[model samples]
Target: MITVKVPLQEAERAKQELMRQGYFLSGYSVQKEGDHLYFPVKERFDSPYAFEERALEARPEQPQGLRETLKGKLPADVLGRLKTAYDQVGDIAILEIDDKFKGYDATIGKALLDTNPKLRTVLAKATGHEGAYRTQHMRLLAGEDKRVAVHKENGVSLIVDVEAVYFSARLSTERKRIMERVQPGERVLVMFSGCGPYTCTLAKNTEAEEVVGVEINPRGHELAEENSKLNELTNVKNYKGDVREIVPELGEFDRILMPLPRSAETFLDVALGASHQGTIIHFYSFLHEDDYAQADTWIQGVCDRAGRRFELLGSVKCGQQAPRVFRWCTDVKIL
Candidate 1:
């Protein structure tokens, strides 16, 4: 029953240091007691710089999900080729298995279930997102046969069909960032709001008077409506169909959210139609590191041509899309 104890504030730094030195246990979450923090370790080791180790009640190490367990079980060559990244929704784990590893899908799925007792199903992604719905196919590798999953984000629950609509758990941070900026009684519009994550998060977390979300995918729209009720958000209004068609009818909004990074630019004209003199717009895009200014420039050009001036509020790298490419968000105010 040995553990590494540190002041609560230094716990994170200590755990990170232990992890860097390959002495930290991956399964147990950091535990806090009064002003002290405890981190589980495999065995006693020399304490780095400012850390101390002491014997404490031994908590059984819980096996973390697939990735960590596979490292010691699988051959180095096979393990190196496998994708360690996956998405978990409710009790399901969604994965993108490479073609070469197709034969081992069942084995991997079982391992995932074994390591993570909470997960009841594992679905292998069969294709990339396509069409207006932005959905892909999934094959059940193990456990339950259902594709429907209820995911929670930023205090709101969203029900989604993995094969019928597109959603990303990776965007949770971005959703929270945008939601935190909304002011009381402000009217907000979320374009391409798959499963209503952004819309519901705003409605539930902020005092916005109304949050309207437009989706092209019927399935996603239906789930969005369900999510609104699930979260008991009376301010959310979901519309089915293309944003281009829906934006024209919704009048002007105090803030507009364009989450479709790759194609958000193409819909700027329609988005502008739903804006007033001081509408705040959150525009998302994917750009290489060197082309960081491209999204802002494009928005400026469009605004200038339409006789509307815009103030660049700020820009940030939301997430990494690939090696050098990143998902960027540019916040601007139309004036």
Candidate 2:
């Protein structure tokens, strides 16, 4: 095996480009010196790197299992638990690590970054999504020390502070699903629109005349406004206030999106106020598998109390949170 020495700062970018062109060794880890980084390559190319036909130092081949590799590298008792799943927003990787893995966070983070060269930072979630802002506490485990994430979805750019607001790449499909249902020249309202993912995507992809995103968190609203400009979306309007107060003032909308899964049921009345007859409402909620009827019942009950007939357009599982708990979205028309 031969090694190629690349500038330390350019190593990651060169590695990614090399991998994309099918030149990087799959099972080898990058070796670094103070000012230069070395990579194992099959043969020398015309790239800007110093190459030498030196015998490679012996090292263990990269393992397929992340946890197994970490266990082999760290003290056995330090890794009490491991979470292998994470959400990547642009160059940032977000996930939770057990408290027992505190001292080993850098090791785990290095492994994560080594495996995914495109990632520049890793944030370990310290607490659940709590408080009125629906924000999660996070700590920088490795790589760059920045929290701002620039995520692109369906050709729209979303700039958000992960710790200040809620952003989920898992909901990319759900966002697209909702965006497809919107028609041109229609006014849309997205309640609890975090960082303008839904609003910007809709405004950029669809011809919605006006897309108003109502968010209670001031920071989220600020980012949403920034994202709208970043994506060059002129139709997006961000309101920084409670949905209950903002929705009523916006009058009626052709389509309304309630994305707060845990507490969307409580805000149905306000959503109704912003809806006219034949208005489409996309309601998201978390429900157990056995009680499938709970979401429909609650939505229907809300419509009935408001003297409006509800037409169930569709119901589908958006994503799963646990074994039995699932995030479900229902599309309904108010008549």
Candidate 3:
């Protein structure tokens, strides 16, 4: 159930009547807009009549603002708006946060705080921006699916839906796992760079000479740039095109990340097209619970064709998408 604070002239009497109908409210306050009342809304109403009566009795439209009515925010709407702002310019990132933590509930800027007559005398400076650019409605797409999250060094948030966490969970150890290992004076190539998470992540952590990432989808490309800026990774450059074309122009790099799980095998030509004899082609592929040997065979075949050998560096159980089986990772070093 969500709580909404409504204003009422006869709040005491209304509270008594509402309690008789299994509804109870006890908070009261007033503002320039008018006297406001606080009420608790049930998670579910018995029938349309129950909902209708509550709205009629409270009249939510009369409130000073509609912010009090929101609860259990949806993630899609914010993600959609983020894509828009990011596409127009790569510097902006969508600040995804709990709806309960937004609006006046959000970190009130000093300007708004200064207007409070009591506060004006206590402070000198009063100003800041959180950069959250959406209002209205919230919901969550929840289920048994795997989860993944992205964050950069620039105090920017990059949340992405990983196909499977068993493989993607590497994100949690950003400071230790991958980001911390990269040194200065290196060139890195990130393919299938969705939202530029890994690309930006590596760039932020490494003192590398250059960091290049390519994403096929427009939304992902836009996010990649935004994420790059979020991490304040000035050296990271993103190509808003397919990796097949972008990889060739990049020439050679010390390390190459082949992150596309669906058909990473097919893109071997592209990886080899830009890679040298000792370049490590980090790849991801989906396999059955017992297909480890088959997966190894597949990797061997890929290595042989390019006249190179592969050494399995690590494997991670990212998370589960199925009841019996889970997502897995195979980090191979190609030489």
Best model number under TM-score: 1
Q: Number of clashes in every candidate structure?
A: 0, 0, 13
lDDT against the true structure, per candidate, is 0.82, 0.82, 0.49
TM-score of each: 0.84, 0.80, 0.50
Q: Which stretches of candidate 1 lie over 4 Å from their true place?
A: 1-29, 33-65, 71-73
The sequence of per-residue lDDT tens digits that candidate 2 reaches over residues 60-90 is 7664334545777776665545675677777
Lowest lDDT sum, 10 consecutive residues, model 3, at: 83-92
Clashing pairs in 1: none
* Model 3, global lDDT: 0.49
| Reference-based TM-score, model 1 | 0.84
Q: List the residue pairs that clash in candidate 2.
A: none
Q: Which window of 10 residues has the lowest lDDT sum in candidate 2?
A: 13-22
Model 2 lDDT, full chain set: 0.82
Regions of model 2 farther than 4 Å from truth:
1-65, 68-71, 75-80
